[model samples]
Target: MIGVYISILILLAIIVYLYFTKRLSYLLKSKRKLLFKSLNKVEKWFLAGSLIATFTFSTLTNLVSSVIYELVSPNSNKEFLKIDEKQDTSIELISESNEKLDKLLKDASIDPRDIEQYLKNLPLKDGKEETNARIDEWYQARKISLEIKELLLVVTKVIFEQNEDLTNTITFLKSTGKTDFAGVLENIQKYFQEGDAEKIKQEYFSRKEKVEKENILILKQSIKSTEALFAFQQTVDLYKELILVEPTAENYFQTAYFLHKLKYFDEAANLYQKTLKIYRDLAQENPRAYLPNVAETLNNLADLHSDKNEFPQAQEKYEEALKIRRDLAEENPIAYLPDVATTLNNLAYLQNVKNEFSQAQEKCEEALEIRKKLAKENPKTYQSDVAMTLNNLAILHSEKNEFPQAQEKYEEALKIYRNLVQENPRTFLPDLAMTLSNLAILQNAKNEFPQAQEKYEEALKIYRNLAQENPRTYQPDVAMTLNNLAVLHWSKNEFPQAQEKYEEALKIQRDLAQENSRAYEIDYARMLIMGVKLFKKDKSNLKIAKGILERYQEVYSAQELLKLIRKLE
Candidate 1:
């Protein structure tokens, strides 16, 4: 088809050249002249020969020029840089690469930090002498990296140690495998006392600099089989080569997964797109194996979009993935049904965001039904998923004013979450707290004030504990719960309790807003307004609220400030 188009284009070009160069006008000297028929045989033969010669010569010249230019062009090399899904690689080669990768990764972590800290602490700037502070940084980084690498390597070995129960996914997920390499850090610290810092830096930090250089090739666009796949730069280097050499979907998919986890969203999206394209092209020939991959990639990309608040793109990709999963699940329910439920739950939330309440309810209910069956079969695997779906369902029921239905779902979801938290608090505590908070909201709406207060206190306790450990992540949750409890108390005319809760919540909000006004200022403002309304007659609180409003007047507007102050009056 391309050849045919090129042939037609060349033919048009020749005619245009002849017309524009006046060669055609030479044949049509006068309107009345029948030039070809009126011409003598010799003249006619000469015209035909000239036309044939010109056409042949022009075609050959253009073809030769195109060949030469393409051979010399820089863009000819660009194709090699991209992962071409249709490249004709030998099946044997692909299989060999797969086997090699499988052997390497089957029992391996692929990234044991692998001198990552060493690489990071190595002096990137090399103008002046390395300061003692710089040396100290490198020493500390090495000490930390080495210990982490040792600990993770031990864990990985235990987890994937060719056990008889390797297929027991639950055991792996819930593995409380403890490392025996505990006192190694203490020993290192004891030997490398504060006075021996110079010697430690000389022996450890400087020596590892040479060793860590091998990882830099990920940037150099070279492939090495031994490189770690966790650090951003190193993984990019290794995977880019894998994509170029074998062009497998796994290569792109794994890289994208890591990048997404590391918050490299843009590059992760690009790799996911490439992975999806490859899976799609491969699926045209082998749908059974690659279609699942296509759906998975779509789901991941949709998640990335949702995280970035690109909701339209997220919804579109999720629906595409959902359709694919639903079709696959009809044929192989056990294999693909979970994916169907997962996508349904994802889309349900998106629908709720778009205010498509009916569709959201439908999706959530469908997901809940699917997950319930799956959880019955494999409680350890699918129970959390069931709980998640139920939580969403309860919210949908609440949206439609089905209080009893919403209450029932929320209770069931909280029961599952609380059980899961008992088994693995590190994993499911937050889930429990979140459901408790939602249930409390519903209770408050139903005016079950005492029940609401109980649930709020429970959630607030969890949030306070969590905030003590990770204030940056859980402080906002703490403040929000406090505000809820305060309002509950305020509505009951419990002024002392309300004042205490409101003061605590507002202080947290103020601290958080100081660090990130864009995220927390509105919450601070809302709490302030609540406080002012609750204590309208309290001269001290009103004065303080007015002062805060005046301080933040520029953040909103002077008119907005005056109106806020008017509410206090």
Candidate 2:
């Protein structure tokens, strides 16, 4: 193309030069008629030769350039030429389309946390117009991607149903056109026309199973990347589809596990029960093979029941798991004693919650003995367990008002936690904070005011920092510590200090209640009542406290607050 343009320009320049120099006019003069006529003929021949040479050179150069482009450029096709012509107007559109498609794929492949970050960092405008535009673009892109995926899925399904060779079909489609995914449907129609019945059925099932296996693998990847609730749900649905194809124990167990993580307790419990039944049958036939699985499922079921506060059911399942674990431990204590100890600890905690004090104490003692022995041999792993048991025992003692005994246990737990925290602050700081809080409560009960105040302050500092780091998880702990501090001040007859702490705690609880009333509203109401009692003689405080109580009158704690108000009146 460039060569042709250059040749045309050169020929024009030559003709202009001849005209400007009067050479053509001199040839056509009448002063020497014969000579002028001969010159005119010669001039005409020269002009003709120049035109032929220019035309021939331009054509030959352009042909050679076209041949080189075809040989060197990988995308040199008729479509490439068409696209090149439209590149200027369509470049941005093509780029945006590709970007949206990439985003859709990324959204499918990433976890919920990543999705949250993506959404959080998305650019925003001052008005709804830009936001609306972005949303519309996202929706359109998502819709298109989904439609394309669905089409592919349908094509795959049809090919499997017809018992055709998918590899062959894919190759054929590519041969037709590399980007011609739509051609898959046309290929499917051709396969249907060439189909045989019995052979096709056999091939269909074989190919279907292969494709199903591949899909299952992909679904597992999706599950690993799925952290958002909606993504988890979608993954669960995919698991269900896989189960429909092959209702294997692994499939059912995986689906139930995801449900449990999602906190779908009822559904998870049902699936776990089904899993247990399967494992029980398998274990009965081959105890050595599947008995361990039975025990594992029983433990999981117990934990699930415990989370739902179905303590009786939880205890029953725990005991069954404990029995199996005990038998297993007797055969190989080195391998299974840890499981035994963990189950005993779990059972002990549930017993304590149920106020079966003697039974809880016995279980805790057994767990503590096992953990102590394990820690003696392997403190790196079992020392934390020992500390945990000591803490639980301390809580039981505190509840029973055995102040000295509770104090002894709390001191032991706190010592271990302090050492652990020194080694790994991120892991053990919360434990240290909790133990300090418990010790402070025990100290207050013993009327050791100065000691209790110091402990409370220490715990309060830790809780404040933790809440600052992750308010969603630790804010409630901060509120609890503030309330404890307020009680300590009240015990010491420091009314102003007590009131200040109570107000701070109440504000936090109120903020929390806005998000989850069932969890925090009772605390808010109780704090209001404490405020009322602290300032019963002040008209302003009483009025404010009464207003807060009246506002939350529907709360369970409101009745107690109302009684305090009535006595004050």
Candidate 3:
């Protein structure tokens, strides 16, 4: 009844507005003005009273309707504003988390006082028991919550060495779905004081203004007791920072070398390039002493750039490096053959990327021929290098979309890697898993979905097992496989399941990307863009998709595919 009344009042109000605007009033006046013009004063007065009463009634009804509107739908704009505010808050939280992670990495040696302080400031639950109970409930409600939280908790506990109940914690986690907790253990081993002592001693000895022999001897004694890898990493990082201030060719080379080991590609590339420049200047002044280092540095820089997909830049650097190596090999035929072969392989890789399959094939064959000769004469000594070269050839074949050749090469490589991994499960399983995953990628590309899934699952099992043993190294890999599986599902039009897996992958990437250098940022951004596109298909999310696409290009450009993307309607 109230709604009907309000609707009628609103309609009448609209009519009144039209009349006042002269729309309705003009129509009525045109037809009725002459009829009213001859009216007597008393009659006109009566007519004016009726008109006034009707106007008063309509005005009162409009006022009542507005009051009802306010009561029923009060402050809708404020409610919408609140929702927008929360979304902004979430974005802010994500940004803050990233910053915190960077700070943690930068001040790795600073004893995490800030993280501790933040934890203390965070509102505590009633008690640890109560919190545990709630967590258990969440675990029951969402199986993943318990697994993820426990993995994080255990990893943190191991890193901090805070709790004595680590055995129980590990046991509990081990009982859960095949989650990788090994990363925590590895971090523990890396950070434990005694484990790092040797590294510290070595760094101490390597100081340019060398420590006194007596000091070195004392440091060697101290090394027997120090175990923390994190401390060594901190020391190494400090040394790197100091080296940057007055970077010599040697210092730059050392920094680049270590950064490469740490997989910090951008930093490593910059350092390597700087080292190359310095060495080149030195070589121009005195070619004999610095040429070898200059050539090696160029090659290293080329390799780094190649890995980062700066193929054109990489090709130029590789050619320069190859010229140096080839010139040196001509002079020192016996000693430089291996280096020449390595350069050939590197060149072949670039050629493969450029789709010059025949040229790449010739280069690989040349490298393999040299390696085979070396291996035949000294099988035990050159076995591993020979195996690796074969693997490289296989990869080149894969690049050319020649599955049979690639598969054959992989099989050959697998035979070697399998044996090696079997002899050392802890060291080799991860590599085996990686190989399996690469093979899986090939399978997926061929639309052999079931086979690809099998390979991925197998790789996942290995990675998960390794992650269980050492998560820092392997959990992210498992997450990647999970994502791959999800993509497969998505390709099959299994949207809901794909979404679930994507969310899972996102959770893992969120954590891992925090620790990774900018080299991995593109991968993270791609995943984000892919997720947004998938979600937006049934909705309109042009803005979010565009933002992700923009970020992806920021980290990576020069790909031709981006032009096609721009052409998208």
Candidate 4:
């Protein structure tokens, strides 16, 4: 009894110590700035190495460190978060402008030139369109015109050639629209008069580097997290220059895979083609080394062609790829099941797209059988891919107007996307929105208006928020949604709502057309025609419509106006 009691006491002490050390390390460590800073390179390395060697230690350490660091780091001088309010504001404004412009441009009812004029007049400072846009935003937000102008001068010098005039160089930045030429020219003259070239260079490069590094870091994180194939493709492209400087098959292949995933068929196809060529040259010397790569590339190329709507081309490529896959599967059945299933699905998708429904069905079923079997064998490894194949099959059914089947597939895909979004909203939200939009469009087509409307509204809300936040990408989509909503209203005979939405869309499009007078002018003419047709009976509105049309007719073809006017008459 005494010996047993002693043994129990020792065991209890060990358990208590293990718990405290492993789980409550945060309680022991000082949650202080000095302690954090004291974590030197060697300590960090050791921590990392130890974490890798002992997952439990690393996990606990990371958890404790993260909680403590976050709690304590708030007031620390080491947490240097230097944000330029001016740049943030500028980005926001550009995003707003792009959204507005996309709406106006989509319907082709507004005069592009007039829209351009409106954009030019929307209170901007001059440089390049992007520069002016940034300046305009910054000016409105921070009132730092002199500082911005100096920065622009330096940017022009650094990004362009020695002989390039700062004014002209800044004037030609057409990313947003035409630069305000007169305003940019004045700023340039002022910059030269100030005689602060060196200061300008230093400020410009610092900001530029800061912006570039910030974007690169964001992109790196995005690449790791994003499920959207196109976004991932873009992320890969942004890093392409950096990766190209240190080229390897892994980097190249990953980028190529991302491109392929995005349905950028031409680019993806080219990448795979190059990859295959490399494999082919090496195949003679090292058949074992290169065969797998060649096979994968062939399969990728086949899928690329399939996406491009080139059925025969896709078929040929898939068959060639399949021969290799089949041979591998025969030699190593267990190892090759996944690849074989993937090839089967790709071939099926191609056939489905080509309207070879029966063959496609068979291929999908085959792939499904393989995937299902694999998923059952190893749920964690194969479940996601199985679900993907299920969705593909659902897509095939959907194309055939097999609504029940398609809905089932969509439900599965939605579940997956929803879970993904929950885990990483920033990376997966866009995809969720896209899927919602697609499903909504289908529902609308099927006359499920309420469900469709709900889906569209939800998607529009997310897209609008995204566009407002990242105007570079989502703004145009928001405009499109607005236009789509207008059309929906118009179809329902909600004339007032339709007109309001259309006008809202037109406002955005007009802002975007600032650089292209001809484009905005065309759009303005179309809007005039629509306005005249819609409001001809209202005498008060007709007068303004006719007046606007007459002024716009000077820029557009007289014949188009006369035709519209004749309709009114």
* Tens digits of lDDT, candidate 3, 1-569: 45455556655764575466455654467756654565569756765665566666667777798888788976535533443343334323323343344433332222322333222322222334543454455456653233344432332433333222323433443554212432332233332322343444444445435323223222322221121122335434544644544466865775576566456898888778788888989999999788989888888888888888899988888888888888888898567778888888998878987888888888888888878777787765565667677777877788778998887777676677688776666545666777777777877888888888888888888877766644655667878988897887787788897788788877787677677634344455556556655655322233433444465564334133244344332
For model 4, how does the per-residue alpha-carbon lDDT over 1-569 read when each residue is reduced to its tens digit?
Answer: 33344445555554465355453344246444554455579755754554354545445656777778778765322211222232233223323343444333332233222332223332322424554565456556754333233333333332222113333433433322423323333343343323323322233223333445333322232232121111232344443543344344544555566556445566666667667777788877987677777787788677677677677988998877777777888878788878889888888877876789878978888888888898788866665666667667776777778887777776776777677767667656776776676677667667776787787788889987766544545655665566666656666678898788767766665564454554444554455455445533344444444554566665436457656666666
The positional error of residue 158 in candidate 2, measured at the CA in angstroms, is 35
Deviating ranges (above 4 Å) for candidate 4: 1-289, 300-311, 330-338, 341-395, 506-569
Candidate 3's displacement at residue 518, Å, is: 5.8
lDDT of 1 by residue, 346-425 (tens): 99998898889999999999998999999999999999999988888999899999999999999999999989998988
Error of 2 at 190 (Å): 30
Q: Which has the greatest TM-score?
A: 2
Kindly report which residue stretches of model 1 are placed more than 4 angstroms away from their true locations once superposed: 1-230, 241-246, 537-569
Clashes (backbone N, CA, C under 3 Å), per candidate, total 1, 0, 20, 23
Stretches off by above 4 angstroms in model 3 are 1-294, 297-317, 327-334, 349-361, 375-388, 487-507, 510-543, 556-569
TM-score of 4: 0.42
User: Tens digits of per-residue lDDT for model 2 on 130-248?
Assistant: 43454456546663233233222332233233223334434543654643332433333333333312222223333344444333333332232222112344455655655676565
- In model 2, the clashing pairs are none
Q: After superposition, how far is residue 247 of candidate 4 from its true place, in Å?
A: 15
